[model samples]
Target: MQLAVNMLLKCSESNLIERIVWLDDQYCYVVNINEASFPYQLTLEEVIESLQNETKVIVEQDPFVISVEDHELTEAELSKREFAWAIIQSIYVIPAIFDSKLRAQLIKEASEDFGVTKKTVRQYLKRYWARGMTKNSLLPDYMNCGKTISQEKSFTKKPGRPTIYDSAIKRAPVTEEWKKIFRGALEKHYFIKSKPSLKYAYQQMLKESFSKKDFQSGVKVLDLDNAIPTFDQFYYWYRKWYKADYVVRKREGQREYLKNYRAIIGSATEDAKSIGVFAIDATIGDIYLVSTLDKNNVVGRPTIYLIVDIFSRAIVGVSVTLMNMSGESVRVALANCFDNKQAFCKRVLNMDIGEGDWPMHYIPHTILADRGSELISDSLTSLTENLNIKLSNIGPYRPELKGICESYFGILQQHLAPFLPGAVQKDFNKRGGKDYRKLAVLNIQQYTQILVRCIIYYNHRYLEGYPLSKAMIEQNVFPTPIEIFKWGLSRGNGRLIQLSSEQIRSNVLPTGDATVTAKGIRFAGLYYSSKQALKENWFSQARIKGSYKIKIQYDPQDVSVIYLRHDRRNYEVCHLVEYQSMYKNVTLEEVRLLQLNRNQQQADFEHVELNYQIQLAQEIEAIVQQAKAEDDSSLPKDIKAIRHNRKMEKELLINSKYEPNNEPPVFHITPIQKNKLSLFQAKQKEALDDDYQT
Candidate 1:
């Protein structure tokens, strides 16, 4: 019953009155919301009387009401909002705003100021008062202006302009019969597997629907000059009847529609409550890399595995290796993800990282991956199952399901790769083109460091067009991956799973069988030993019981250590033995390569060794023949005489001292020193001679 600005009153079902301003205690200025009219003075008593009699009611809603923060203002709405505000801004404070003469003068002044008619100013003022007196109230009524062609209208001639070239030509109205023909032709020709163009479809429709059969040739000819609708008319009806989705599906097939044309119903972050879902994928880096062992050796493109937190779009984990994309590589990347980021950056990269520079280092609750052989392997299954982590594989060829991870790959390969050395250019495969592989400079380790730097930058980079939640917007959270990640950790359920590095490795590392022999525990043709193995006397047992296989987990990236899995979460760490030290700090792949080279070298040397042995045997046979020819058999024929002669030869050989070139003795034989002076020294000595001379 009380009058206030923007207050709504329903005088009837069709009439809505908005109170603009109070003229006095008994009267107030009001405006009709639906029609273009100036503000009119209405008595307060009339509204109160209507309310008392139940003839009018208060309306709470204004149809034109909108929140500026929520709705995007179009250019039309912006122009109107500014125009209305400009007009009302000057006259809204006037004391005699409701006075007819004063209102007319102010309207005239506003019209001149804005280069609009006086009626336009009055209409804008009325709208401002009627629709809650807000800037949005002046927004253009676009919904009312452009109407959908949902219902057909009857036309006498045509509902559009005449032909530009031939206005005098008569055209028939599009009737129900023509509409039926249009639908049939569109479905049969346009919306089909062939997906013929609109013009082609129209020509086909004319040929089939409005053609005459020739008697002699029995060929149907199209009616080009008359009797059929125009392509524009046919297209209009087709658009109205067949929606974009149906058209795409029928023309392009269901798979194409689902993959490319389907509407996005929700966001990747919709179900992500925290750091729970991480999407992992692999790509062959566009740039070729050199070998970590020898820089001159081109290692081809490195297989890069990236783990991204879907909710925050942060690059949580990255792995660059010369190994192929397989379950082992995925495991190594996952292990790195679960390891302490600070220690990893320092130990492997030898680079210092500040606090929160690359803070993502926890295992996510669920991992989303593509249907790669590596991801769907039994090894990955066992690893995730043992660690209580969920693994999900997306449908084949559906990259949009894991869009954030794929987007990062595109950014890296397409956007960032062009600037790097040895990057695969588009024309590299063309005939007589330069080979980009020869330009390789960075090794796997150096490339990984560069990737780390890029990832750190990506994490902290401010995101544009990010879909922030209402609560996050209210809290004024920055739209950066790192900031969003931090916010999610604090605001969400904090589902990131934290575990010891050993526990993660025990489950995630690749597993193989190692034989326990008398000498050592052997794996990959190399020896390993652990304190636990020694304490359990495994080697001694193996010696007694013969060698046996024991299941162990190892890092393919480094062959120095392997884990003996005692149970699900327990492991005994083993290291390479002293004799196997040559394989230390080398990958399993490298070890295999070295073993192959060693085998080839030995094979090459085997023939040479055999030739030397054969020559030595021939020489021995020749010596025996020469001894038989020069035999002294008659000298010692009896057994006792031969034995006596052998003893004499042995004694002579022991007593003889051989010297070369009659020079100083090769063997310096010193006489044994006597405890006291010898008799010869007493008879003649240098010291006695010196005393005599003195």
Candidate 2:
């Protein structure tokens, strides 16, 4: 019944009322060119009833009959000439025709009845006896005749202006001089960023065509006699000769014009099997979301990472985060794609999905992404290599190459984001009515849950105008993306490269290089060491001449621990030390900010030290006066000032006691000579006695 209704709707849409008509109340009359002699009359009520009952309607065959054997022939196997002879011979075989007085009358009647020319009948009768009535004898051989020429061009004149007009026009209207000037103007105007108007190009052509030069004797040389073509004439010639160039120049700024207008000779998605090519990309979501930790704090738009299968158009993985688009987000999204989504839904959202509700949980054979810094980092390359997945980047600014993933972002924004409270309007004018930031109610977790539900719904729901798979097209059915994926899987063509949780955690996480110091392995200004690292004496080992770098994988969301690849198959987990444990739940961004703050504080301390050096004496005097003013022991004394005063007094007293004298005194060498010892010994003994007295 629905099929009939749909057919009726199509017929109405196509304006086929004359061909399809409702007759009486029970039947529908269909008029067809091939069925002119016998029209079709279907019982509409009976068809609908049969459809509702899930039964078939049997169609009967026509009763009219005709055969060539009804008429007797002179020869069973007759060629064109023999058949003509047979028709002529049939007149005599009929007794009534043989009895006719005039045989010409009978032959004429036979020619009319058989729809043949009398001339052809006569020619065939003339050659009948000589050809022995055989079918092969009447066959005409074309060995003597050459190849046939096209009738339309056989008598037509050669393409070019006639000689009569050549002399009259003298030279062509678009001569070599005209072509030179027009080409120069076109190059100056059309093939440039300014993209000047056609009228301006014509003006330029005129300017170049007419030029003047100053002579050395002050006489002017000018070419003002040549007539320039009108703008319309130039436009006509340009349209005829350089239409493609004009189109290219007109659509220069539109990237899609090149993609759509130009011919693409190679297939991008057709060569891949289901789950063969996965395109990953990130976009800022339209709706605003708050931080999960603080409901009142609005984090603005979240970055959404999408991983779409090129073949099935299925969104295999998605990640919604307050973090910017970076390698970390890509890693998390890829891990989600490789891990079982059923388990993920249960663990993350606490919602149990049915078996195979989300069937995508395998690494793609090839991953396609844009040349974004986040997607093209060393970590992603290393991860893809470890997973044995090929990575490719599309040309710059060519989103159409990764169109499957790019289009999904728009689809989600159009259909889902607008319905949310904090949804941002695409047009600035539409946003004037409401404050979208104030409307933000969903946190990152809540938004993620909504995103998951939306992905599931998109997979299951039917999408119109989706390209049908080969099987679906053959079966005359339309299926959703998930259905197409399942169909491909059932045909045993889709590949599922499943990975263990450990494999995913090790290979899909972002990686960085760290060095083992005597204290521990330091990475990102923080030290991390495990019991296993200590047991293996990694720190005590001698460092190489350059950097003793080791490969480590870490989660950006948690800086507490990092995984060190100790051997081919083992990864040891190393935690931050006690002093750095405060960074346990901190993000990588926070850690970097904290390091910047510490460096800033150290700079501030150096600035203070410099100021103190310039006022050293004044600071000492201030400290001494403050200490003397607080003389009462019961009162609270300035301990810091007192310490400064004591340090200053000690330095002054030592300076006075060890003061050096440059002035010369009266000769004291006489006393040394009178002594019983050498002059040097006497002086050393005198200096020792003075030191003991002091």
Candidate 3:
């Protein structure tokens, strides 16, 4: 039967008898053995049988058999041990003895040339190749002292097949038992928190002689402590067991390291500046402010719709109203921005959500936003085409890209929000979450009021980014965008700004002629048109113009065609237009129906225009009827003819005493009457007349 053992050795014929004793497996009784000169492996049974066959006397001497124990392994039967010993001895050799021919240079060359794995080469070196190349640095002659091996209990050579008695599974030599534990038992754990080196704390702990458990636990909490490997023999076990994966070897010079670090940091900083770009987002607004000056108790916060100018960071336009942020604040804010210079917006403006696509009117350049879904709201995309913005998103993890608006809000919160008297706050629990991104709402009024006050400060204050404050003031760098507008205008800016619009000349005020007054002066949508206009049913359409600042008016439909009367262009020329805002539809039947509706509506409104021709015809008919009733004796034919002619001419002209004459008297030519020619001519005429009378 074959058997296996952990180690093996070989010896030659002449030394075999001395190296081998009988059929034992555990220990060979060595008398005088030259292991290198006589290399051989022989089973214990072969030796025993050969000895029996050769000798005259057969003596059975299984001397002093000692029991051995090791990790619960029982000794195999004699037959197996015999062969096992042969196999083990065949592999055994002096631990550090190497073949003379093997050289470190040759090993290195072979290792490189063969392209062998480091592990495999390491195994070869450990097993068969390293002895000749390595230095004997592991202490003294003690390293190879066979006497020392005999002195150690683990290495004691007992009789045939002695059980491995040490119980530590055939113990390592006393010289290396601890090293084995250090290397094997406690290495290679990656700790969660890095251990800090605490030289002073360690010194104190050592002085106090704290137990190992106490030391370990205490060291964990010290902040200044560093993960330091042991420096003394006391730490030898740790050196082998818990050796750090990384060792910090201090470089002799920092110039190269600093230069490389600077280069890396500089490269990263430079690249971060320009790579990802974003587009500006635009939003229109309508707002209402519950009059702040009013003493009445208000139910809700005053609302103001403000159109934000993302580029220069300005409020492009705004309107105050008593309406919700959506229909009122949002629309009004948008209205102010889209209005005619002198009128409120007559056309629809655009807004877009951040999704890359929107309807044609909804298209914008790009939207810069965070992960919030409202930033990509679908309702907001309704007019994306009108605003030229784009959809851009920052990486999911990055915070700096969306920092512009955040930074602005920071400024608002710091300088403005606190001053607001009645900001409302709604906790997240109350949000109900239908709108996933509703920011915690606070009373918007207080903050908005502060916002209005702060905006002037924001605009006019000398900004650090703009250096020359004096130059800015002198150059009017901080003019309100309204004053800065250079579009359509008449003579003076103040006239445009300060003109008292009640009295208009030329029957034409330069206002966009979405409306006209009774005096024939064209105005924007707001004025009271004539009572006569009411007869035409102009009032049937519930149109109302801007109450205050700029000119704007509304129609139930057909919002598209309101034109600028002075320039004679559709309102579309001014800003982006809403398509469905117009009342008109394309079909001819629709048009006819609209006209009929309009006629009926106009006639039904405040007043109506009575046709002059119809009235005149009725008057003439009345006269004819009266004459017939009078038996045709009312007048003669010639007199009636003249009177009828005069009456017809008057009716045709539709003259009234109140109407101004088209022609004015000219003084350029004057021929005096004979009596009034001159004082002398009058006297001569009087004298001649008197002589004639006499």
Candidate 4:
């Protein structure tokens, strides 16, 4: 029966239970556990038959069947401890059967076999019965029988003789009167100095110990005859108590201690959801780039503006330009973040990207940036207010607050920048052997494309130590930035607030004040008025303090056209004047540089014009003199005629102007001047004829 129960328990443990089809009569049927066809059938009759056969075998091999002589020899071969333990185990196996005689017999047998006394065996048996009859109950409790003391008593301090310091002090104790003397000495000779040394303080203390009167007050004082402590004792005690205090006093008004010793507390962004917080920062890229328009012109290192999502540490947007860090770069990067990046990737790089490749295209709830002039502008403030985004400017020197973006910059320099030509090596000495500037090959457009690809790879690549979502944790998988972003959105925890392209342009673009004139709207020394802006008499409005100055938003990369904010909800596109086509493709920086050049040229023109005006005045005066000579009756006819000709030449020179066609204008000289010129010619011809006749 026990063997059958064991067999059934084993089958149940292995999940091999089958249904019992029939429980009575000649046979009992059982089906497979999983209802699958089985090769052999299991039944209760077979189990009963197997149990009967096992019972017969157990009876045949029973211990009672063994001879008494053999059992006794086996018992005698056991060791003393083994025999003792066996007796203890036997007494507890069936305590009811172990009567007085039985117990005595067991004790006698243990004593005879193991040499243990009957009295000890009896005691062991008594202990086993009194306790739970376990193996541990039969063992001795050595803790109570040993000489070990309690932990608390052993750890307690024992009273002993006085310490060495106490003995030294007993030999020559420092009295209160002696301490007063030391204080007086310190105040007079040590504390009064700019920086007092301990040795000098000790000497002063010794001197004051023998002084009769105080320095400030001429009064007699008690002298320390021989009770003064030795300099060694004084110095030891001073260091133990007053040394730190003195150092602190001497170091007062110094902030270096605070800076070096203070602990810095940091903040975290893990609690924020995707798109809840963003950190925007700019850095000069380590690699140099050539201009796309002119290869010879090294545009220098481009400033890369990066916007990172604080939660997933994902790069939301990036913009690289030869231009310096400004509000325009910030605007462009943020616009890319808030607008669809798929279209941008396609339009700019002509790369087909899936939806999950770069899922970030939403405005963040809050933005954190350094206190740069470009970031802290009125335009950013206005845009943030309009978009309902909270803008926080971290204090200067607190790069840790925006550590995510700062770390990303380092990662870019270490990982991506090194692969490109003209990449500035981190160590200056490394570049001594090679000129990195000369190695530059990529133009601005190619660099931008590479940057885009790098950003995409960073987003998709697996980042170690990335926090896992609940589902990912169960699956034992680490998530990447894209995974986190997607999981966060699926959980409905992300604030995926998207903005249209027009809305992003209107909000993220930098704004400037423009005055609308009759011809057009003049902004940045360029006109940008369209037919729509001109219609409705927008420029003819009253010239209040800022009434005529309309608010205009523009893309700094393209200055040819700007958007005029007609109202809170509307914007009008304004283009540059037709004559100002030179500025059509110019950037804001280029426009500024152009304006500077124009100002310099204007100054040069003014200088040249001043001298030309003075010379023209002199020429006009000479012409007037020549005209007066022509009318004078006292002057000779030839002289008058020559003067008249000079006047006519001057008039023609003043009247004619250079033309693009390079054709000289036909000048009609006055009738009087022409007759004077013809008479002069005829007199020359008559003189020639008279000379021939002579």
Per-model TM-score, in order, reads 0.50, 0.43, 0.23, 0.45
Q: Which digits, one per residue and each the tens of the lDDT, describe model 4 over residues 1-694?
A: 2121101111423444333222222333333323332113345457566447642121111110111111122223234324556766554433322345665676677778767688877766655433222233343443235454333222122123434554312225555565676666665665552667768888766655544676668865445443446666566546644545345544442243333432222223433644457889999988877654456656678788888887777888887766777777888778777766787666444567776677777766578887687876556664664454667766658999889899988887778766798888866447446677888887655777788777889888888877665666875544677766655543333434455456666557777898877657888888876777667665665333234677788766567688877543466788888898866555565566556766888998997899999999999999999998879664346554587669767765655644555455576778986897798789878887898999
lDDT (10s digit) by residue, model 3, range 413-485: 4454343333332332374522212222322233333454554445344444533235335656544322222
- TM-score for model 2? 0.43
Runs off by more than 4 Å, candidate 4: 1-267, 270-275, 287-300, 321-329, 343-357, 370-386, 390-401, 414-423, 426-446, 473-478, 534-548, 577-586, 598-694
Error of 2 at 520 (Å): 5.9
Candidate 4: 10-residue stretch with minimal lDDT: 60-69
lDDT winner between candidates 1 and 3 = 1
The candidate scoring highest on TM-score is 1
Which parts of model 3 are misplaced by more than 4 Å?
Answer: 1-294, 302-329, 337-382, 387-400, 417-450, 465-535, 538-694
The lDDT, on a scale of 0 to 1, for candidate 1 is: 0.73
lDDT of each: 0.73, 0.62, 0.31, 0.61
Better of 2 and 4 by TM-score: 4
Give the lowest summed-lDDT range of ten residues in model 1.
Answer: 64-73
Count: clashes, candidate 1: 0
Kindly indicate the candidate among 2 and 3 with the higher TM-score. Answer: 2
Candidate 2 per-residue lDDT, tens place, 116-215, comes to 8876654443333222222222334332256544432331322344445332112235655676777778778766666667788776666555545646
